[model samples]
Target chain A: MELSNIEKLLEKYFEGETTISEEEKLKVYFTGEDVSPDLEKYKPLFEYFSQESTVAPTRNITLKKNRKSWYYSIGIAASIALAVGLFFTKTAPEPNHDLGTYDDPEIALEETKKILNMVSQYMNEGKEGLVYLKEFENTKNKFIK
Target chain B: MKEGAFITLTNTFKDKLFRLAKRLLVSNEEAEDATQEILLKLWRNKSKMGEYKNVEAFAMTMTKNYCYDKLKAKETGNLKIVHSNYQDDKPSLQRQLEAKDSLDWVGKIMNSLPEQQRAIIQLRDIEQYTNPEIADMLGLNETTVRVALSRGRKKIREELLKKHNYGVV
Candidate 1:
């Protein structure tokens, strides 16, 4: 790469007319130590661009970290949410469980019959006392006659 | 795209993405954040990635837009240079200092550049994307891309020449 060629390329570069290869030639010439003094003013500009290119992110973005199975992650997250929802819904108290109501119709019917039978037996005892009172009233009526 | 293929596609250019972000946003932390976001955004849209002919250029375009939005939102900040790879073992201390000064100066000059020009120079010169690729990434025709790039390069050169004449070295 002659200095004349580089000079022409440099002019072309500032004009935005240089080919990519021609721009590469300018970067190559200027980054090396042996630039002619006349082009020294432009050295820093080219060197700045090249040097800037060498700058990688100081902290790695850790593509590896992000590359983990995102699908598996999404699946785990969804399952956990569903599990939490299910647990809350299941553990919440319901109104009917505390009541002593029977679930089976046959058992409910039998229990109802037994309760009514006990009530009728108490009623029959009271009615027998009333019969004694009726006999006492008949004897009183005979004495009055 | 498959996960494996998507990862490979993005892994190749994450640094370039970061560099472009840093170039436009002028902050390492912000640039890193922007890179992460853009990559994640790419991942979220990976289903649609197959629709494009060049995913790399698409990603670059996204970063350029993201940074422009950020710049519009944050209208003020100083230029901060982060050259992690430039070594400290220069044989002569003065030469190294001079290089650093020049870099700092260039960084400031670049900071004042219009966002479009900054993006153009970053894509074309540093990333070495073809002019057509750059034009496509920026949503501009080839002529506008060329005009902005040369204008940017000329501005930097003009500033460098000014510093030289002023005995700033």
Candidate 2:
């Protein structure tokens, strides 16, 4: 009520001695339309606190936008990685070598020579059979005569 | 605890937890994230919440710790201050006309205070917490709480007076 008492309370308040109810009283007293000139300097501090009590914090638009972008960026990055992996995996072909290169050319030529020799032997055997047939026919004719 | 009790804790403490996080982190987005994190933590530790004698205070303490950890991470990483996207419904023309003066500057000034001092003021003045309760929440001695609050108020007063060029009796 008295200015000195109010001053003491203010001092106690600064010292964190005032209870919630006392602080509320101070808020009420200081917030009056007719604040004394002597206490005018402290008015802003109390006003700040009072105003702060009601001041809704500004919404963090950037953070929310960032979060959305973060998810999108991650999705894009994952897709790009997956596409690169698929391209590399699907487009590449397995290496093949010709087996003919591993064979000896001399060995192949010798095998061809052996096959030709076997064909000549078979021709000679056919000629010999024809000769034996002609000799048997002459012997039969002589015996019949 | 009972199902109803968990729901009651959330209902009762959501705004208070949000306010505390907002004050400590000075960003609505961070506060919301911090609130959700705190709530999740509470849900995970619901049994512990039930065991506490003062659930409100415990929840407040949890919120403060979570916000403080966020602040520390931001500082260590040198993260930029990110803005929030949450929209507020516009007030009516009459309400806007009747609105008080802008306190944004005041909030900035309060935010300029050291983390510990700012937290102490938030708990003591804004949250209407007693010194002992605040000390318990902050893991500081009650004397430290008083000192921080006193010093914080003095700094706030000095800053406000310097800006306004007025002397208190």
> Against the hidden reference, what TM-scores do the models get?
0.66, 0.62
Question: After best superposition, candidate 2 residue A16: deviation in angstroms?
Answer: 2.5
Q: Quantify all predictions' global Cα lDDT against the true fold.
A: 0.85, 0.75
Tens-digit per-residue lDDT, A1-145, candidate 2: 6788778889999887888899888888787777778887677666767765664435331212345457989999999999999999987997677655527879888887998999999999878878888888999999997
DockQ numbers for every candidate? 0.43, 0.16
| Candidate number of the best lDDT | 1
Clashing pairs for model 2 are A59-B84, A60-B83, A60-B84, A60-B85, A61-B83, A61-B84, A61-B85, A62-B83
**What's every prediction's RMSD, in angstroms?**
18.6, 23.2
Put down candidate 1 lDDT per residue, A1-145, tens digits, no spaces: 7888888888888899998888888888988999999988887777888988888777766544664478789989999999999999998977676668899999999999999999999999889888989889999999997
lDDT of 2 by residue, B1-169 (tens): 6656676657666767777788888778888877767666676687666578887788888887888888888889995767588655654454343323325545666788998999888877776778899999888999999999999988887766555552223
Report the C-alpha lDDT of model 1 over B1-169, residue by residue, as the tens digit: 7768877888898888999999998999999989988988888887887798988888898999999889877755546578888877533555446545887777778877998999889888988999999999989999999899989989988867766776454
lDDT of 2 at A123: 94
Show model 2 residue runs off by greater than 4 Å. A54-145, B1-4, B79-102, B166-169
